[model samples]
Target: MNATTDLLPEWAQRPVSDEFLQALTARFGSQCSTALAVREQHGRDEGSIAAPPPAAVVFAQSTLDVQDAVKLCEQFNVPVIAYGAGSSLEGHLLAVEGGITIDVSRMNQILSVNTEDLTVTVQPGITRKALNDAIKDTGFFFPIDPGADASVGGMTATRASGTNAVRYGTMRENVLALEVVTASGEIIRTGNRAKKSAAGYDLTRLLIGSEGTLGIFTEITLRLYPLPEAVSAAICSFPSIEAAVHTVIQTIQMGIPIARVELVDVNSVRMVNAYSKLTLREEPMLLMEFHGSPTGVKEQAEMMQEIAGEFGGNAFEWAERPEDRTRLFTARHNAYFAAVASVPGCRCITTDACVPISRLADALLQCVTEADASGIPYFLVGHVGDGNFHFGYLIDPANDTQRQQAEALNQQLVQRAIALGGTCTGEHGIGIHKQGFLLEEAGDGAVQMMRAIKQALDPKNILNPGKIFQLQ
Candidate 1:
């Protein structure tokens, strides 16, 4: 083994003995995996970096099973990495110090939906799409959409958000409560079903974005929104990206309650159109959605059009038909994959930075100009309504020069974001990818407090070690 691998803790390095595997198999039956390949596959997430495989993979089917596994790991001094759908962009699910990967996909079930209370309880492994589909006939919707069909557990862990975050807020806002298994094998519910409370310590918020460093989520209670009376979608083209961004800024300043406001650059538009088999104009465009009463939506759209005109934006192409709107959004939702597919054999180094609304256009222009000069293939997309955007740098990983350039660009972006009174990461948690940036953003005193909290909750550091904050 390499020196880096050799330096891992004893429990992380020691192989899963045949005797232990036999015992696990006897206890969990068909839920345990002893194969090295299966264990390795379960260890890593969708992050660009590769990680060491877990010593074992346990397909947990219930809260009792998760509690049992946690207790066993605690007794054995083994680290536990909670595995959901493995769809996280950050290295949230990577088993850096190999131990056990508790696969929660089998626990996918919606426990209950309290439409009157505007809340739902579900097992952690349930995907957002599954929950939405289940509640579709109830006239309620869960709006914490992060584009990907990620598990509720993973979404809660990462505190994820997407286009609609401008209106419905993020997981931090929607997750009403969580059922988590602590390092000591204790299951606790952090919050209640009430609308508001002056609860003690706010533990729910602490675990929502903990990224499995403090506890393994077993269940989640999330707030849901009633279906809108009327929804309108539109695609507005701009002569330049600055115009589109300016239009968004002005629209927000004018108090338009836009449900979603997304920006797709010319290159991104081209890729999505080709990948989705559509004939959209290859221009810098803004995809907007307004939700409210019919009169309200119409008024919002009209006001937004006037603001766009001021910024040299074209007339809004309204997707009034339900099918047309779905078609448009379907293409938008597949933008990341489309951009990735544009370059054969390319891995995407996606990163995002948020800035103050007034400084957004400048920040985006700077990053786009730098990317243009870097001679690297990239596409830009943003939740411009909230001054947050992501740049996908499609690079051949084997090319050292390209990888280095991409890293440099990412660093520059973070630096600019910090300089503009913004965060290095807006919605994505401070997983391994953004750990260094966290230090840069949150000062030494703030970081020390975070470390204190982590140490207090996970003294042994057996839960998701080497993530978020490194040891002193």
Candidate 2:
């Protein structure tokens, strides 16, 4: 983990005084917990990064609850970390500076839905699936999946995207307004339900990817889309990863409106097969979906089939039944867990690098070659149509050497993506794990500008302290 150490913030944890704890417990009673188990749960996320548990945990049930917790922390000069569904992959939920975590999971609810306006306002803690389920009868659904049943607030904080991001945009584009609890415990609103607002600074965009550093989101208003009239999913296996990548690149370049297109490398395919009990072809595969009118879906499928065939892709399979499509996508989403399960007592250092479409082949191929040569076990998967992909390099938790090797591969991959005019992170925000990469990718001037905003908005630097960029 030495290689990863350089990516962490250079800050020491602040002590949580007895006075603060007593005050918090008095204010919230049972809702505030100092128990080790609850603190441990609030301290980490899905990623491999580790930290000491937060000093305390506050289970917030509503916007007022969050605001009160923030106020208490602010008064005590203690850092506050906002926690959602705990699905983040970049250590976003880690209490790196030893603060109290405000858990908003209990705040899950659909505040309002405007079907006629194609928008919905929700509590920060509602998961994407839950929101869809509550509004399924309304013939509208939110498209930002992020593979996890992550809280909508978490998605908004991290600007999350997933398989559907290719056609529909990421949270940065989909989120319309936010009700936020600021560092000083003041509640504020940014943006509104209107589609386009030439209004003041784009505070909504500013906070979308802030990773809980700018402000803690209590309520989020998001754009919604009507359920497609016709939906179709297909899978095609390629002779090699390059062939599959080329197929996707060509498909995107040709302006095909693919709803979702993902790549599963040979290694991931095998893992998925064993984990999901489905005998998919043992080759690099592209799982694709198209959404539109029946005729339009057919035309898109035909076009994809033709393009894939031109690249020597075969074993084309179509899944039109709802159950079949669900099964296939479930397998796809389970790829990460399957890989982890393959290696007992191991965690992975996942790299999220996205390059230009034309440079995707070069970036991916180089990373694959290096990962293969490094002798580190890894699984590759991607939302390739959008030139964004992930390589989860499995590393034994007890083996520091493997951790270093995985971090080296991640560093090389991020550098390659940056050199190719791409970003170090396409969807995952810069948590403690990617702080250095953010500096390298955004440079000092841009980062300083961001820091200035942070200083202005959170002068005390208590909002998810020790994340994104180092303060001093």
- lDDT (CA) per prediction: 0.86, 0.91
State model 2's lDDT: 0.91
Relative to the true structure, candidate 2 reaches a TM of 0.98
Per-residue lDDT for 1-472 in model 2, tens only? 2355654555688888999999899989999999999999888788998888999999999888889989888888899998888988888888878889999999898999999999999999889999999999999899997898999999999888999999998998899999999998899999999889898999999999999998999999999999999999999999999999999999999999999999999999999999999999999999999999999999999999999999999999999999999999999999999999988888988888989999999999989999999998899999988899999999888888888888889999999999999999999888888888888999999999999999998888899988887886
* TM-score list, all predictions: 0.95, 0.98
Which stretches of candidate 2 lie above 4 Å from their native place?
6-9
lDDT of 1 by residue, 1-472 (tens): 1111222342235344566656667779889886888887787665566677888889999999999988877776678889888888777777777678899998999988999999999999999899898999999999987888899999999888888998998999999888999999899989989988896889999998889999999989999899999999999999999999999898888778999999999999999988999988888999999999999999999998888888888857999998998898878889989988899988888887988888998889999999999999999998888888999899897887887788889989988999999988877787877877888899889999988988888887878887787766
* Candidate 2 lDDT score at position 472: 69
lDDT at 307 for candidate 1? 89
Task: Candidate 1: give the clashing pairs.
Answer: none
lDDT of model 2, residue 57: 94
Clashing pairs in 2: none
